[model samples]
Target: MLLKPGRGFFFAIVLSSVAPVAGATALAVDPMTVLIREYSRGNGSYEYLNSGTDESYARYILDRPSSPYANIKWSLLPSPDTPTRRAIESVSTQEHPVNLRDLHDMKVWDLGFTKAHIASETFRMPQELRYVPGAWSIVKAGIEPDIYAQAIRNQGLEHPAMTANYALAAQLLRAKLAATPPSLWKIRGLRHDVLDRFVGGEFMLAHDFHYLIQFLDGALATWDAGSTSAYGFRQLPAPLRLGRIAAAYRQRLPFEHEPCMEDDTHDPEHAGEGTFDRRPLCFDDATDRAIHVWYAHELVQELAAIHDRANGAPTLAERMAAPLRSSRQGWIGIPRPSAIAEVTRIEVVEAKVTGQLLVEGDVSYRDAFGASRRALRLSCGMRP
Candidate 1:
């Protein structure tokens, strides 16, 4: 059922006795253990997960050996949150019941995020959290769905914000799938291509470009007119040249030293204390290379068009502007091979979010073959 604002407190009380699934053979250790280990190490605080009133309840719920998989019976409850809730309620009341297997390939999927709030607050790392060597292998082999279902059942839809967040996630995933390449054969150099194809011909490399554009557009739409900074103009790709010209207009100029108060709010303990440290935003150099390569290809097409012109007497300006007839032929700018050659090494740091899946970690790429480089931290929610 879709949750509604101001009704979460009562809904939580109605579904308190639901049991978690048991007998998951794919996972060596439970999901809660992994989340605790990562959070404790990153925050450098022991009691954050282990020694609280929340920890006692978590141990009671998660430590038991039982199968937590059960279709949520939203029909028995007195009040459902939305009209969508009535639809799910009707389905649950059927004589022939639906199961998790039925939802595997379903297009309209909703994964409630309120589960994270409960897991983050209650779960403690087991004493053997660090000793589970085969943990990741098990998760990758497809054991996360059950763990996720268990968490969702445990946290029942209590907040409308949770439903809204999940709806956004569903939209993003659908968009990504729709833009995916139909087949690997259509994409050049399947052997050399670093990006993976999914459904259409659009490369994964182009996904981040669209995200950056959206970010800039949203900021500009909501920006204050009195502010001194240029809003929409900042969407232009960072300059390739490392000279004074590039440094003068870099995007970092706007928020380089500014405190990342927004990101710190994720942690409630350090909310007002300002204890969380903000890392520098590292722009992807590979994106710059792709942009330049696109430009160089356009230049070649323009040169060919000039040679095809029959009169052969047009001024240089007209010949130079011939490619502007097609947006695809727009100037990409000069090719910069140095940027491609700058990347040195890429390392992945794995962090567990809810004990079910190991989300994306920090990916550090050294530039100039170790001469100089930068690091970028990514979240699992961010598509690769």
Candidate 2:
């Protein structure tokens, strides 16, 4: 994902300073302090396991309740598979292989497939046909008087995994958009394609868009409340909200520019005679609209929610500066970023040992996108 050059630089500064010493404070007084400390320790454990040679040792350490490393080990468990293996298996073996064409032929409001075996297959359908597949196929197949009469009865059934895939794809997209920054260049095109597909009557893709919009609405509501509390505002401006929504959209889609070559030998059962296209979906005309659209919207909404919540209280700037006051000298500590970059200097702006610590810093970097842009600046402070 492309992040705006300025924001990326700012993020680098915050990460370097606030991120490093984020958990240094004792948790007895500050809840966030304690949470950070615990999380850090836990994160370290998983990092060790992931990078270490012994998987069994990692599992053993995680299994021990009283182990000092327990939290990390437990937290490090890999995310559960998005689509349950059982569900996928059920759909794959179902009597009828529900393909994209099937979904495009079903009736709108026909919820029978919700319990069907090929739930995941529903995701392959086009957007306009999402709710009323039968109507769509009739129109596309042409209204021959005789053929049209039986269209409703002949509508194809979709597999349960189709529904499951659509749901999962929507979820994954939301997460990506939320975690990524706005300057990521690919997001705009991705978002545009997602919206276009939905409005253009691509029903399967529209299902994804609908899901994304719903998710965004929920996230935005939470963010708005947070903003109201922190900034003393009744509501966020419409433009800001929309911008946030867009940002969230971009964040969810993964960096799929890298080519993916599939090896059928890895999964012999699913492998076929010809070479398969294993490439991750890139936002393009040829991309699968259902999957991509769902993902993009879901991601943007999530990111917007996060930014709204985080930006609500003691803005990042203010938070980063809290460690610098003279009175809080004893409580002052380093700031940490989520990631690291080249650092030039760290400064204490304010502090009150009896109160909180504020700190700031400067950082420099050539853009991650390799534009050769250099010497960016950022500031952050933490209070405890």
True-vs-predicted CA distance for residue 117, candidate 2, Å: 24
Per-residue alpha-carbon lDDT of candidate 2 for residues 11-104, written as tens digits (9 for 90 to 100): 2111110001111110112211121223223332122112221223223222332221121111222221222222223333244442221211
Q: After superposition, how far is residue 120 of candidate 1 from its true place, in Å?
A: 18
Taking all chains together, each candidate's TM-score versus the true structure is 0.20, 0.17
TM-score of 1: 0.20
RMSD of 1: 24.2
Listed per candidate, the RMSD to the true structure in angstroms reads: 24.2, 23.7
RMSD in Å for model 2: 23.7
Error of 2 at 377 (Å): 43
lDDT of 1: 0.23
